[model samples]
Target: MTGAWKKFSAQAGITMSEPVVEQMFGGERDPQRVADERRWFAHEMRASTYWQPDAAVLRAATPRIVVGIGGDSAGQLCDRTSRALAQSLGTEPTTFPGGHTGFVEIPDVFATHLRTVICEG
Candidate 1:
């Protein structure tokens, strides 16, 4: 799973430092933590497999839709998907600080930006 994380980070253009990797794994000595992370990944995979978005509902609510892409996530999966969604909605995505994990990495800045976006609407 750690290798999977590394591969995913690489594919996503995210450079994970040793400390960050360690933090993700909950320290080198914690096998349970690693297992927990693997379970989480599995759960996400399962959820994604079964999840489907209703295009009609999304189109109907386009005016209230606020597609946000991370500033540093250019060309990444989330960025591409967000752009596509915004395009389909006849709108543009708003850029936020950092990448996909921006909210977790820069909570304060992300929250502030989110608030501003919401207020502007």
Candidate 2:
């Protein structure tokens, strides 16, 4: 968890202080709850956990949509993911502020972009 926090802080360009770090790790008072959440996320990432959506139903009910790619994301992962999603949705990916966790790091800017996307669509 410490390593993950450090990586996240670096990726998000957040300056972490000792008190904030302590509060973050120390807030997980319930060990069982944390373990359960971790297990749930692990299970969710498994390929078998996903179901194929029906294309016909998807096309019939799909609304105007845009795929948002994080402008500050490192490497090509976010770009590839956004492109793939956009292709699947038949829409172009729109670049948004910050990285993969952009919404958390830059909530105001992200919210503005999100609103713009919805309004423009």
Candidate 3:
């Protein structure tokens, strides 16, 4: 049986890139398969999002903003933005770990490690 992904994408106006298609399905495939995988990829990445507070808000409120960076996947862009905000606002900077998915995958253990950083500072 055929699904309506192609029809829907065309109707709504969306273009799926090739690599995005491959990553979702786990390997190289024909065009129809690629298109289906693209649909899956869109669903997955959009489902989960990490929320960090606004840097501007942090800077305005805190006397000194201490940015706790949580590795690459931990929202380092936010860390960078926060650090930049801290620098602009004259605050302190800090870092921690679990890489990108560490916190979500291993919250208790990551928390224990993160505590060490906070305690030291």
Model 3 steric clash pairs:
73-100
Task: List lDDT for all candidates, in order.
Answer: 0.80, 0.68, 0.55
lDDT of 3 by residue, 5-119 (tens): 4344343343446554345434445888666667755674345334445667766774544565556433344555556655765666555565444678678977887788657
For model 2, residues 45-94, the per-residue Cα lDDT tens digits are 34532544454555566585566888876355456655766777666678
Error at 108, model 1, angstroms: 2.0
> What clash count does candidate 3 reach?
1
lDDT of 1 by residue, 1-121 (tens): 6677877778666787977876774345567776776886777755864565776689797478888999988988678778987887788899999888799889999999999999999
lDDT of 2 at 85: 60
Ten-residue segment with the worst summed lDDT in candidate 2? 45-54
How many backbone clashes does every candidate have?
A: 0, 0, 1
Return the TM-score for each candidate structure.
Answer: 0.75, 0.61, 0.38
Task: Give candidate 2 regions above 4 Å deviation.
Answer: 1-33, 48-56, 74-78
Off by over 4 Å in 1: 17-23, 26-33, 46-52
Candidates ranked by lDDT, best first? 1, 2, 3
Superposed Cα deviation of residue 58, candidate 3 (Å): 5.7
Instruction: Report the Cα lDDT for candidate 3.
Output: 0.55
